[model samples]
Target: MAQLLKRTHMCGVLRAENAGEKVVLNGWIAKQRDKGGIIFADLRDKTGIVQLTFDEGVPEDVFSLAQTLRGEYVIGAAGTVRERSAKNPDLPTGDIEILVEKLVIYSKAETPPIYIKDDDNVDDNLRLKYRYLDLRKLKMQRNLSFRHRIAKVTRDYFDQNGFTEVETPMLVRSTPEGARDYLVPSRVNRGQFYALPQSPQLFKQLLMVGGTDRYIQIVKCFRDEDLRADRQPEFTQIDMEMSFVDVDDVLAIQEGYLATLFREVMGVEIQLPLPRLTWDEAMERYGSDKPDTRFGFELKCLNQIPCVKDTEFMVFRNALDNGGDVRGICIDGGSKAFSRKDIDKLTEQTKAYGAKGVIWIRKEEDGYKSSVNKFFAPEQLAEITEVFDAQAGDLILIVADKPKVVFDSLGFLRRHIAGLLGLLDNKQFNLLWVVDFPMFEMDDEDGTMKAMHHPFTHPKEEDIPMLDTDPLSVKADAYDIVLNGVELGGGSIRIHDSELQAKMFDILGISKEESQKKFGFLLEAFRYGTPPHGGIAYGLDRMVMLLAGESSIREVMAFPKNQNAQCMVSDAPNAVDTAQLAELGIGLCDE
Candidate 1:
């Protein structure tokens, strides 16, 4: 615990220019080797790794101490920087080596379960269980450092743009925000509970009413939901809200932020005024709201084709008879790529997305080979390829189902097939603004109309009339920022009028009393002249993950929960003591 020598230089920064300089470095011993009575080891700090040399020139005790070094041993080495006899072209500090004069052991470490190397190929659970050691890897350290830089850039960009940083409550009243809330039972108010904020959705809007013109917060939000690569139970959001701003104003400010963030952090320039696609157009063309425009598997409707519409084939005929449509996507050169067994496997996977089956046609060199050639004439098969301009070496995949299912099937198929073909490139950035989302969508199970976004999103001015007659046909003043195929974030022009707010609640099947019971504070605040405010919240984890070209947000997070929402390192979500539960007037239920 005694201080021997203070760190004079980082391990990675000792360059050839700094030869003859006496420096002290504190770090873990990454590797150790003894060749011809000279001890050489790689010393690592957060900055980087450098070679440390201990020869017969050092004192007997110092050389004896250097011999004990091993991987992950915490130590301090005071030495003179000199030119390396053998240079490692792979390292930044490769041209120089530290010749040790004194040494001190801070702590000895056991052999780590997980290797402190980037390409170890260790098991996921083992890496998580020993995350502290895993983080020592250069890749993880770089990922965390990159994340820190992103946070700093986010704060700097918003602050320079006249936005006030505001902190909101962690524990607040819970309204239905689509996702389930993680509730904390109150001990003081027996049997009462405080729900974690799904977002600062209501509070941010209330800030607008309180006359805060521009607000920003890199805030934490919670959602008790299913976990995936991108979804975490607890996550951070680069949340912002603005008062007296329309869609254009909010979007312009956001684009400016993106320009600044990408240019500074990634050294990439994002072109101004990003491309846009309406919700309808996105679904019709790509069959997805968050359309990945990097590839060309665009969906084409087969219902209007004369041969397909009039075909006696049950797959097409039955779907058309029941108000459904037939649609397909053409894959260039896919005829040679997909075998019948491969197509069958893909067909099975589409069933999980509610597709009945897949109908395929391969345009060969000689003629067209079709799955439904028995039903359709040769001319009809030729017309199928004509619909997609599909030439020889092209494969057309068709899905016949209800419009929604049909679109959903093709949406997933395009992306899945693209992945199989290695067509999605992370280096290629495709930023798009998806706007004019539907105000309401019919719930498949209940057959009731639910708000496509939340209820507070302002309805399109012209579509307000349809709230009484056809609310599902109405659109909202909402926009989502999408990258590749992922929806990075979304915002809407909030309903500022109380009457309109009430109409939204009513249309979503919430009664007058029920609305007051849930969102009374927000409803009451809106009565006193709320502004035409709009806001967006970006998933900070997702942003950093994408920036780092990582498949999972877990790679960027310091301590992330596993697939079942349990922390492997800390063994979180464990049972609490009975007294603690009793104090909160709660009892355990059988699992």
Candidate 2:
């Protein structure tokens, strides 16, 4: 049976003001120190730790019982608080120590496989295996607490704004729009399965049809796609929707939420309405859709350069004649940092992303030096350097290829170079909206046009007519919220008109029968008079990771799966009994 007495004070609450008061404390033993007749143990709870001393003055039995205590032993102590002679200013409860008059050992624990300290150097896989103990670490505790605070604040903010928190169905029909679905086989309905939602996109739109004006939910979404460092098989999204909202209205509410969140979470005051960057400007300036504007290595297009009129370097001239682009970036003070060998390494890195070769230019005290200089005279190098305002210590890196390859390869190199130079400011967050995204992109493998976002994303009203004539020039009403070059979330106004939706399907090569087969229910719902609505879904796990200042979501999660989406703690997604599968009329096919 457990002790009848409940805890009167927390481990961190017995300060100098409560020095002479009697208090009952309950916690796990953090550390035990023995000093002849006196034994001191640091008792720790979720709040913090406090020192508990069992002395020879009052109870000899208590002092002897304290000697048996070890790390992580759960105990209940009734003690009188006293000021310590030598106060340890490092701890919050350092000024006062608890003098125990009673001690009750609630539970005895075996030595933990991993240390409970914050700085324990255990392997990550081992940590995941012993995740319960890993979560006992102070960092994980703080992370969970911070996440709760943010969630509470978010809910309150949306609620106050007349947004009704609503839930959508998780088990629905599968539609191949984005990531692969996680399907669940049903025993009651044999040969049928329900797919977990990648997002509540269609349901939320149906909510608009049902006249649920504003809907919000901190919902869990699942996808059966391959995971990356920043992705998970299942994750939470701050899903929201609203009726009669334009792009500006959505941005305004989000901006207000950001201002409050940054102020409360990080204690940083953010200015209202973060900057906006167009797709064309963002790609041309930073060679990325989500540009990191924290530093200043902007991509420079050399279409204006006049030195390649009769150059022997066909790479440069051919790119211009073939309707491709020549772009470069000036790395500040890289003339000395990158040796010839280092430049060769950089060239190899870009080649992975499909660049044929890299052009290197070093501005020296003598004259302009370049890898392609043997093919061009000093005068040509001077003309190229002058275009980029190259100083004596600057290094210019150029890529001459198709516009797509040039942007992709050089953009990757720019980020790599920035990391090598430690140009990212960890303390600074550059948030911006990358607006006016292209409606469709040509799939290289299939040579077919695919939606940049989802197919349901509505094209700009002005571009609606262009769908029939010039589909490539159309822009969607999509907006991506990017934080320091990482895309945090993206959304767009959805197609509400059945006529326009049919037209969109035609453009995407979705036949009438195919569209009806996949999205007939959604089209049927749209016929019930849907309102003009749009919403955004932010990755809640990633957002909390950013707020907690952690590198990955695993740190913020209590029991997270590894990169392969395997649960080390519970050993989930394991093989079940063959009889159970047979009962469901399912057979395992050999790969």
Candidate 3:
């Protein structure tokens, strides 16, 4: 017969209040020290860590077993909680010590390759490879726990607001209009494949048409796109959709959901009805649709500045003459923060975003120094200073290029400067809603109109007439919720009217047969009286990453792919047997 060991308390839960109380605890031995006559072990669980003492009072056999413990060995100890002589203020259960009388080794573990500490500076590849051991660290455990709490809070809040959690199929037809899909081969249906969903988009819309008024799903979405710190090939989305709701209705519900989430998970109260900005205003002022309003260093178009158009500086003159933009941002105290060499590095950074070069003006004690001082006279320099409202010890960085390049380059530079200045506060959470985006944006390579959000996004009712005449002038009833500078997620009031949907497809160069072939079912469903629906999908991983104060979504995800979209731990995307491929009517192609 096997002996069963029962746990009466977590390793970190016993405190001075529980002094002299008998308790049984089970956890991994974080660290152990033997002081000749006594042994002390720091036992750790998911909650936290507590000290266990094995002295002469303990049974000789139990004390002998406890002294043999190593860093991550799974063990259980039965003991009485007592006030510690040397209490640790850093830990929660630091005030108490467990006088362990009974000890049992549940399992033994080899020494971990990486130290199980929050500040362990191991290589990310090693961390991912030994993710199971990495997750034993307190920080990683808390992040996953926080993720769980957020998911629970989201489900509860949406359910209370009359939303049903309906599941959608994972394997579906490939719609390669947006991000590249991760296709799965179909063995039964030879030569055909099913692509994993980028989002539960069409199915949720179909649900709305089927009279499922309010739908919510915590679902996985796949995308074979480039990876980043905040992105993964496969991720979870807190997706929701509703019928007969406009922009305001969807925004209000989401605001309520977020408010509840913050209160429950973070214990921080967020003010209802977050700040809102229109797409044009956001882009014009901040040079970005997703603006980080945490700090100030807003972009100012130099077209409005006096003497800019009249200046002999060919950079500004040629830009204004050729219908390009000249924009500048005033970085306070940047004169000292960024040296000349640092400014050159920033100039190189801007080139990556399509800018020819960046012009920098430093406000000195006497007057001003500029990269293009030879082109502008002292009086013209003073005018430039006045335009940017420059004070002594400030730096004005300017970019002159086509509208998109100017915006992209300056926008990225602004954030980079903020990071250099240490002005971005991780503790401060700024939520914003950017609305009224253009219905279509011109693809730089092909010069063809592409849907700004997606083809399903409805054009502003008043701008429907301009779909064929001037598609670029049309605005979509779309909105994006931005946190700090990262875009959390976005959605738009979908085109429920069949004619409007067809017109949108036509504008995007989707012919009748192409539309039928790609989204024929969606079009067919829309013909059955679809409601005016709108909803948003929040990147659950990104949301948790922000909430947990992590720099990457991988910190919050259990198993994630590396930059190359390869799973180092599992070694996935491996070769399959030839018989399996042959049975599926698939053949390998020569590289």
Q: Which number leads on lDDT?
A: 1
The candidate 3 region of ten consecutive residues with least summed lDDT is 1-10
- Residue 218, model 3: lDDT of 97
RMSD of each: 1.3, 1.9, 1.3
- Model 1, which residues run further than 4 Å from truth? none
Q: What's the lDDT for residue 174 in model 1? A: 76
What are the per-residue Cα lDDT tens digits for candidate 3 across 268-349?
Answer: 8998789999999999888899999999889888886667877767888889889999998999999999999999999998
**Candidate 2, residue 133: lDDT:** 87
Local accuracy of candidate 2 as per-residue lDDT tens digits, 1-591? 767458898887677999899999998999999988788999988778999998887577777789999999999999899999989999999999999999889999999999998889899889999999898777888899898888998898899889999989988999985789999888999888999999998898889889999999999999888876678888999999888888888888888888888888789888767999989889999999978888887898887677764554789889888888899999889999889899899999888888999999999889988888788788888888887788998999999989999999888888889889999776898899999999999999999998999888889999998999999999989898988888888788888888999988899999999999998899999888988888898998898887677888888878888877899999988999999998888999989
Worst 10 residues of 1 by lDDT: 1-10
Candidate 2, backbone clash total = 0
lDDT score, candidate 2, position 97: 93
In candidate 3, list every pair of residues with a backbone clash.
Answer: none
Off by over 4 Å in 3: none
CA lDDT, every model vs. true structure: 0.91, 0.88, 0.91
- Clash tally for model 1: 0
Q: Residue 558 in candidate 2 has what lDDT?
A: 81
